[model samples]
Target chain A: MNEKTVAVLKQAFKEFYFKNAEKIITPIRMKEREFGYMSFDKVMVRHLSFQTEGDLRAFLIKEMPHSVYYSCAYYYEPTFAMDEKGWKGADLIFDIDADDIPTRCKEEHDHWICKDCNFMDKGKRPDKCPKCEGMRIDEKNWVCPLCLKATKDEAIKLMDFLLKDFGITKENIEVYFSGGRGYHVTVERSALEELDQLARSEISDYVSGIGLNLESLGISKRASYEKMQRMLPLANDSGWRGRIAKFFSEMEFECYNSNDVKDKMIYIYRKMKHKNFENFVGEVIGKLSTKIDAMVTTDIHRIFRLPNTLHGSTGMLKRRCDDLLSFDPFIDAVALGEEPMQIFVDHSPKFTLMGKIFGPYKSERVKLPLMAAVYLIGKGLAEVD
Target chain B: MGIEFGLEDLAKYPFMKEAGDYVKKLSLRVEDLGQEDYRPAVERAKQRVMEAIQKNYISIEISEPIVELLSFPLALMLVKAMNVEYIIHRYSLAEAIRAESLLKEEKKSIISYIFKSTFNLEPISVKHELFDLKIKLIEYLKRATHFHEPEWKLINRVVDNGFVYLKTHELVRLIREEIRRTIYDRMKGVSLPSMPKNLKEAVHEISRVLPPRSDKFQRVTPDKFPPCIIYTLDLIKKGQNLSHYGRFLLTTYLLSIGKSVDDIIDIYPRSPDFNERMTRYQVEHIAGMRGGRRRYKVPSCRTLATHGLCFKDKILCAKIRSPFQFGKKPLFKKKSTGQIRE
Candidate 1:
């Protein structure tokens, strides 16, 4: 980590424990932190012993890397007077406090990351590097974005990587941004209670078993789903108003069924103050295809009503079939790419809106044709035959 | 949406079909009135027409054929009401008779001289063109009639059809015109001027046949009568409103605003109200007068004039002319050197 990053971590821990640990001590012999040994190549650790926490802290700074460390919570147990084993099962527990060790252990060698796909290399963000002529370095996951070459996917997994892999229990899994370029998944302080003490090592092992690769997180499912959008048809006898009410509540309106739809629509349109209704409401409804899986009523009137058309006012009741294509809902999913998207479900119009002007039998009363045109236009769907 | 609902609802009304059938029958009768018959017709023709109009809009109106047959009577009434024979003769001759002596006037703008020269000799009742206009007006009125009786029934049937219906204004016009013609003829043969001074005296002998109301108006002033109603009637002939009610309203308004009743009676003027109903209508609307004037309900005279008049219908009210457009004309002045100036 850079100096500022180190300062942040130092301040976070020191602010809480600074007053309590004035004369903290460690065992005179180099105390064993953990007995398990790694049989793999390239494993080394620096060790030192101290009488005071200050001395140990100095030693940690002098030896450890600036970033990248893991903590294992384990301690020796004590027993109460057994016959032969004495204090084995019956021994008082003794724990070595890890407060003195820095979070990172610095490596002696320099690190490099790929310029394109994050293939990391050691010995400086290299010039004309072997894997990639595009110069860059990585101390973590190494995939070269500039060159086709890639390192083993298991280059280096941060605590965040582990969290993502195991999908932290809902309580601990708050998503946030890392300082730059990627997201940080913080297993919250509350997670301390949720982690199973007996299977602490198993939890870490389970995270590794997820088979996450650094190079080719091949074809993210989110990306491909955008390519398959469709128009959501109007559903009959559906309780969609409740859903719309919830959205209004989210927007902080506390709207009710009695509230005038036209008034609300007029308010929204005025707030947007955009010359083009298409661009304005498109923003709010566009994100909603996935989350709510339906468009809001506020979207329809403020935009697609198109009152100033050449003919005259057109009204819609239960969605009109002819209106489908004009409102081309099946555009790119969330507009991230060229993948189409549609409302997973359709919504209907309120009946009170259309008037009861009597006309020539069914010809006048049942103006379904107008309704179809209205729906298609409102949704921005491509007109269909 | 336009007429479908209206048509259906009308069709279902109990008497509508009967009314429609009767209207059609009455229309046939009116057409037959003129052809192959002179005087004899189904008895109570006017009553039949009224009932037919009550049932349906088309049958009540005088058919075109009926108007042709009845033209002489209609035309006679119109000429008498207008007093056009004397007026036209004087007006036409006054311009071209520059010689001051009748025989010495030279023929200038020959048609004008012919009119000026022949005007006195031409029988007031027999001018073919004027008679033709009268006949045309009668035909127009006939077109407005219903196939059945009563004006309303006629309106119900032929509202948007291509028939040329008369407005209240036009009805008012026809009334005045008919009165003018009738008065003109009544004066003929019954009385003669024998060199009466002031055209009014010459016309007076003829105007005696006028309706009592018209006569009362003519007596309002020595030389002036209420020309307002008469003038309004003249206006509606060429420029008319859509309904007869509108015509009545406008003419009454003109009478209220224009000449005195004595002035109108001094001319050929009459109405049933004229002989016995000449009561004064007084109003006080000044603020703080008569016990603090709390009676805000009392409308202005102009507004009061609107009440009980034929044009009470809002749609008909559209024809009511602004008071400003109905005021008197400026009298022509004679310039020096014996020349008439406008």
Candidate 2:
């Protein structure tokens, strides 16, 4: 970003932090957590510790950083180097992002530009530039209602797993809108807090259904329909067996007998070719499993975006969602004002914000709401007029 | 504390916490073992260590309860004085095996007491259709993470309301792991006092009988490769269409053991649809030279099993976590220079 855009974003963020410093809630065990932030100049300053919520608020009011983060882990010495710090435990966190989930709306709103050849196109970015064969491809992803809805569904699926399979109580789970195209579910003060990285990886795999085997559920490839019906997992079975059996029941197959849900599913499976059966199994797994960022859950020392803090890319607050179904990120997470400001839009996709639609602009100067102007300016798609 | 075991029970499983309390109550100093009165206990201690190293199982000969109780601590002291890593591991395993056998006949309350007082684990007795005892999920995970079998995975187990249901034998196995770790930890970091003449002679004899440490990691040749790698290599050489995971396994295994990118590329020419550019790019990527700049490691033995690629040689692959760990000892007798040949 240019100096002007940075200055504009910094000023807006400073004013917001100065007025709403109390809205940023203090995390549990503030003294034992590591705090970090990215300055306006993009230099990350980390390994910082705060003793109280007052200290954290004072630091935010003074520094006015572009983004703020806190560690997921608790350490004995929060300000020490990575290896020197005694790691006590970490909260089990999962990040369900719209970027990882596939939605058809991305083809309409997302685009990629090759830095080397100046070629721009829509849809997902390829690994290498098709025109220039260069590796420097810059992608511009814009969130839409469809993509955001996909992420919310994934978050719901994840919570279902946590509640049913892992048996974590609802009160221990906190869901947050990431201020930019994602949801982060954190499990705190639970039995999962002290799980090491390997065990956490297993939990991630279980929720995501990474290594699920049909044979483990007694669904063998060579078994006949009659044999499979006899050996099929019942709907009352626990864990994945129960889950797969319930999925089979909900699949709505034409049944000759009403009580034979297993028989109907087996009849369909017996008719499917070997390749089709694999695809059918894949579809079942896709519906049952969550699409969580495995790396985030597996990383013990990762820093996450602080709640109620502005995300630099979108100028929105990472707001906590009490009811995930009714929470709308574009409205609830908007932290900037509605004062009008003029900005020269280089290029941007049409987007919705706070119940208003903005233009798909091209090199035009327009007076937009301060929140939209800041968002466009932060994304490097607009400049101060 | 209300539940008490007899002296015979204490002697049979001397690593129990109550046995430790009994030994502390005796107040026997190290010098007391050198006297003629404690000669039988001292000799029994030496025999304990020797049996652990030679037979991998200590046969219980508890003719005298006091002597048996005293010998357990003495044996621990002797092991700690030697302070060799291999001996500590073997002795701990042997002791844990003995405890497992004795625990098989104990009552539920007794097993639960040992679980709490010894390992600090809380296993609640429950009446379930398939299981008798249930431990908290986190407690189960703390020990089960070291296990590589698919059945041991938390996803495959019977868990409800954060408790994992386990059978009596399974619970005994977890206790065995805890006992092994406790014994191993107790046998470390000891500064021995001046030994008596007879004790010194026992130490010298034990040292003479100690097995030589094997240097299995020294030679990295194709003949020493694990069965999975060898199977993948055979498939590649036979011009069979290998899966993506098979190719990844072969390439990473060869690259990790210091094989050059070009040499690995040469092994892939037998594939019917060989493309030099694509192969080079993939090899370079896995080797950490291109894209992400992070070298890929060979997946663990459990991962291989999940992927259905593990052609397990039960004896050769025993206790090995990764493909690189296989053939740590030579698979066959051979006489050649320890060098990688193309």
Best-performing candidate as measured by DockQ: 2
lDDT winner: 2
Model 2 segments more than 4 A misplaced: A214-233, A252-283, B29-44, B60-67, B189-191, B194-198, B215-342
lDDT (10s digit) by residue, model 1, range A73-171: 112211111122111110001111111111122122224457566665443345555765654534331111111001001111223232332223444
In candidate 2, how many Å is residue A106 off?
Answer: 1.4
- Give per-residue CA lDDT, model 1, range B176-266, as digits (tens): 3222333333334222222213222323433443333334334333223223333445444444332334333433442443444323222
| B173-259 per-residue lDDT for model 2 (tens digits) | 877878987887777644578878778888888888987443232357668889999899898879987888888998899887878
Top candidate, metric TM-score: 2
Model 2 per-residue lDDT at A2 = 74
Error of 1 at B33 (Å): 34
DockQ, structure candidate 1: 0.00
